[model samples]
Target: MCGTIDLYYALTNKEEAKGILPNLRFVKETNRRDLHDYIMWHNINHLTKFLSKKYEDAYTPVLKVNNRENDNDLIWKKCLKMIPDFLQIPLSSLYLRYNIDPRDKIRVEEMADIIRDTYVKSFRQNAWMDEITKNNSIYKVHDMKFKIGYPQYILDPTEVDKDYEGKMEELPSHICYNQPSMGKRNRAYLFGAIGSIISYFISHSFNHPNREFKRNGVWESWLSNKSLEESFKELQNCYRDQYSKYWINDQQVDGIETIDANIADNSGIFMALQALKNRRDMNNVRYTSNSNITEDQLFFLAYAQARCSNETVTPPPTSPYKYRVNGVVSNLKEFSDAFSCSRGDPMNPPKKCTYWDF
Candidate 1:
């Protein structure tokens, strides 16, 4: 009886959810009637269109209104994307073998260790937190588990199919944008890019890096000390004020609104730079730049390149991509040194804000 009632409520909520969904994939300005028709046609023809543009008329306007840079993908690319729904593991495995080097697992694990060490060092040097809090932070990093890559067993399709419904697949979250092509990037940039992404995803998972809350089991925090709380707030204000002043397309960034992403952005860059510095490969010239560019310069360039885009989401919780690059780079003196900008220049302002001052 309860299961039947639960099913009835589930169906009812799903029907009610239509009031909110509105078939708006990427934009709100699309015509409702047009979208409704598109959905009806799409339900019938989406698969057939991959073989041939059988319903281009129904989909073209949605792309145009969404301001998509390219309205059409290659036939194979579309098919490849669509096939994942039916053949996820096999297709992903094939893509991994073809594009992602198996050795990237080693790269990711090594980078994760480097970032963890960097975090510990930063905690040790942190002048704001009391030793108690600082020690707890260090302990957390020490105990944190870093899972780097997919399981080797996944390569066996027969084993996967036996319990597919119960298993959660580990996959690359942002293969194209986050992991920039290694050949196009200098070593410093490559390390920075990979290290940044490693820390970026990790940061989002176990958030509030600055706060501690374990009171027992060898790791605990009150998070109630007035002085430490003040220090934490000061750290937040530093990034918040810095971002609040940045204007994009006449809209001032809502620093308070985007504080988490802003903090993650700064922390990612900091951790990545630290990881690069922590490596034994640092010969003061990690990458030989052909165009008189320094290694550190290449690192920042790669970070910016991966993030370079003009698109901004409506009611952005993060700054625009341009500002994300600008805001992060401007906070670090190393960025100014990397590019050799004058101190008073826009990119190298005299004042900067930092947290965990590594």
Candidate 2:
């Protein structure tokens, strides 16, 4: 029931720019929204079919359903669960399936407690960062404003709708053709979109802070879970110490300085958590926030609970996210401080945590 059309419009035959591919049938049959949806469907179907063939080798192996009635179901579920692990999809995207009932504001406040206990304490224990850097890092956490829930402006439907207004619906055919692969691809896209949106909000949060800092002509920056890369780059030229050279992998053809930011991000979050924990313990702060205990423990539990499942496609043998978190944290003095581990704890093992100073 599908046919291709090659339509041409004659405006003085040779004297014409190009005519648009008018969806004449759509114009004749459907409403504006319906027509847009129809167009989107066709485009997606066309794309999936093209991709399925183009990357046939890559996907075909994953798509083969082992068995309909047996343990195959388990495998399918396992694969779906593993998506976040392999893809490193953000927590926001992964949460879409299960409704996160709005946490009690009391519980939400515990985030600050968790920050103080686990994250902050760990940072203070870090032997790597110098005293000045450690103190400044602590100050940053204390000064950080936690914006829970959607921003104040986004609560307005008009503004929210405008931000997401133009989404087109893909046709049923598109879904049917690429149902197997669509989930992963769509999830990936969702993460990317969310990342961009988050970056925007993080940027906005800094506008006022930057303006005030600018009065003194001093640049101020806010760190997010996502801005670890830029922060490292900022650190690059500012200090060149003995440890900086250690960060440069001697075996790597790419300069040690060129290591992926993910390593630094893992290191930073771990540091932040440790430092927060130290502050909490020394001050006897029971919560992760400015308030007391309401939900601080729950915030720390979230990390353990969030450990994603492994991939269905037997991932290249060893891509463990938890290990990455642990590996970097072990070398940090702040982590040991927050956890109060001796010089040789299993998880927070010792490493020459040297950062480049020059």
Candidate 3:
């Protein structure tokens, strides 16, 4: 059944892939290099957005506040204020290596798992979101799936082959060289980092059963108590609760769309904190803040501060990955306090911050 469904989906998706190939050929013939890059960029963007949206829906409220107030502005502003520590590039060399390491996929999957554990645990600890919301958020995350590295399996290789027809036959000789570096330090660093991330992930898996039980165990009982007909009605209502409003025109304001993955990470954490705060308030949990700011604003500012870094991209601002990760995280007060950011020079939010107090 799984194989048949996969095959059917593959065939259906291939038509769209093939349709784009002729345009790639056109770009090649026209000598328009930018067009080729644009196509590749959008193709990657679509995949990222699709995956992010799929997972994000279960965790976040779909309140799209910001046509005028986008997250990019906040991210960039925070990036500009970042220090050096949070912005350090421990894996720079490995990332730049671009060599086909056999363990690359395994390493990436491990990284995803590590990130999920850290962030999802934080989600559970948030003081703002309510019990039901926290439970739902955690449930969504505990059941969350990971698809690290590229979805090459989803790529129709035949369609890719069709695009390569009559293209350059001679591969770059420089890339084909079979030389292996003998530097032990560099080699150890690369392997060690990958191993460390994997170790963390493997250790976290042991705790998964408890997390799953907490979410599913109670919810399943409530859901199972109803008659079949009543259960179906509740299920239908739940679907409407989440997605029915998305179809209504003018439902939400405009927001910033960014190529930066870190922005989404920042926003996700911010919202989780907000939800935590709401939860805490409802539960009469005592909390104090010296910042004189709403948890919503502080959550966003924390996200912005996360992007703070001392590193600046030369004129054109290359390396969105580095900028998003190091720059943003460096600016947060929470991060700074944990890492000890100096007084009177904390991170700043965007000039036109669209405060999503939702």
Q: What local distance difference test score does each model get? A: 0.68, 0.37, 0.38
Candidate 2, 92-194: lDDT as tens digits: 3233224333333223344344443343444466544555545555555455565543333332345434444543231111101111222222221222222
TM-scores for every predicted model: 0.69, 0.32, 0.29
Residue 236 lDDT, candidate 3, scale 0-100: 33
TM-score of 2: 0.32
**Runs in model 3 lying further than 4 Å from the true structure:** 1-99, 150-327, 334-340, 346-358
Which candidate do you rate higher for TM-score, 2 or 3?
2
Per-candidate count of clashing residue pairs (backbone under 3 Å): 4, 52, 32
The C-alpha stretches of model 2 lying farther than 4 A from their native spots are 1-258, 278-284, 287-305, 311-319, 334-350, 354-358
Where model 1 places Cα greater than 4 Å from the true spot, the runs are 1-82, 161-185, 204-224, 280-286, 312-314
Model 1 RMSD in Å is: 8.4
In model 3, state the lDDT of residue 166.
39
Q: Looking at model 3, which ten-residue stretch has the lowest summed lDDT?
A: 252-261
| Candidate number of the best TM-score | 1
Q: Lowest summed-lDDT stretch of 10 residues in model 1?
A: 2-11
